[model samples]
Target: MIESTFPILEVADMQRALAFYRDALGGVVVYSYPPDGEGEPVYVSLSTGATSMGIGLTESPLPPGNVMLWFYVDDVDRVTTHLTGHGANVIEGPVDQPWGERTALITDPFGTRLHLAAAISAPPDEE
Candidate 1:
C-alpha cells in the first residue's frame, strides 16, 4: 500500500542547504535532527505547503541523481527572480507551456534542479 513519498537529497553542507531551502525558498522547518539550537543537524525536513523534502549531510559528494524538485508557486516569474538573486541559476525563464502552466527551471546553489511552475490562468470552470 502506498503511504507517503518524499525526496531526500544528500548534501555536503546542511546549513547551506537550509539557507537555500528554508531562507530563500521560504520552506518551513518540519523536522531537524538536532532540533534548532542543539548540535549541528545531520538531517532536516522542510515543507512548502503540502509538499515536503529532506536534506541529509553527506561526507562526500554523490553522483547527480535523476531528479528534479518541482514546486508550485503563486507567481512563477516572481519566484524565479527571487531564487536567482539567492544564488540559483536560471536555466529557463518563466514561459507558458502548451499544457497551460507557466514554468521556470533553476538550480539551487548546490546544483539541485528546481522546477517552478504556476497555473497560467484559473481553470475553465472558475472562469
Candidate 2:
C-alpha cells in the first residue's frame, strides 16, 4: 500500500542542488540521508510550502526524458511483487538502505521510473 508520492530530481552536485532548492527556492530541508556529518548528503527531502521533493546526487546528470516518482509504501516487498507481477522491470533492490528504508527500483511498462520505499526507522519528531 502506498501512503504518499513525491518527485525526485537527479543532480550531479549535491551542494549546488541544495543551494538552488534551499536558498533560491526557500525550501525547508525536511530530511537528509546522511542526517549530519562532514560530507555532503547523497539525498535530501525538501518541503517547499505544501509540496515536497527529493534531491538525489548522481554521478552525472541523466539525459532528460522522464521523471521519477517516489512512493512511500507500507510494504516494499509486497508492492514490488505486485508491480513486477504486472510486468514492471525490476532494476535493483527491495533491499535495506543505510538511510533506513527498504527500497526497490522499477520501471513501469512505459518506462517511467518508480522508487518504492518503506521506512525502517521512526522519523524524527516534528519541531
Candidate 3:
C-alpha cells in the first residue's frame, strides 16, 4: 500500500520557480538541498499545510502549458487576481462549473499551468 505522494516539478530557473510557488502560492520552503551554498539550488521542498511539493532545477527546456497544478482555495477570484497581478497569465474564467466549482486557469511566467478552484457546494462524501 502507498503511504503518501509528493509531486516534483522540474523548473528551468530555481529562483523564479521558488518566488512563484512561495510568494504567490503561499508555500513555505521547508527544506532545500545544498543549503546556503554559492550556486543555484538543485532541489527545494515546499509545503502549504499538509500538501508538499518539490522543485528542481533542470538544464533541459521546461515544458510549459502542459501540466496543470490544481489548488483548492477559499476564494478563487481573489487568489486568481492576486496571482495574475503577480505575473500569472489568466487563460480561463473563474466561472461556475456544472460540477459545482468556480475555477480559473492561469499560466505562470515559465509556462506552468495552474488551476484555482473554489467549491460552490459541499463535495460528495467519499464512500
Error of 1 at 23 (Å): 0.6
Candidate ranking under lDDT, highest first, comes to 1, 3, 2
Per-model TM-score on C-alpha atoms: 0.91, 0.49, 0.86
Please, what are the lDDT tens digits per residue for candidate 2 over residues 27-117? Answer: 6999998877856799999996667988888886666457876767678888787767555679886999877788999875445577888
lDDT of 2 at 96: 90
Residues 11-75, model 3: lDDT tens digits: 88888887788998899989898786666678999986669989988898767645778898889
Ranking by TM-score: 1, 3, 2
Which consecutive 10 residues in model 3 have the weakest lDDT in total?
A: 60-69
Judged by whole-model lDDT over C-alpha atoms, candidate 3 comes out at 0.85
TM-score: which is higher, 2 or 3?
Answer: 3
The sequence of per-residue lDDT tens digits that candidate 1 reaches over residues 9-120 is: 8999888888889999999988999887899999998888888899999999776678799999999999999988888999998999877899999998888899999998
Candidate 3 wrongly placed segments (more than 4 Å): 37-39, 124-127
Q: Once model 3 is optimally superposed onto the true structure by TM-score, how far is the C-alpha of residue 71 displaced, in angstroms? A: 0.3
Query: Can you tell me which runs of candidate 2 are displaced by over 4 Å?
Result: 68-127
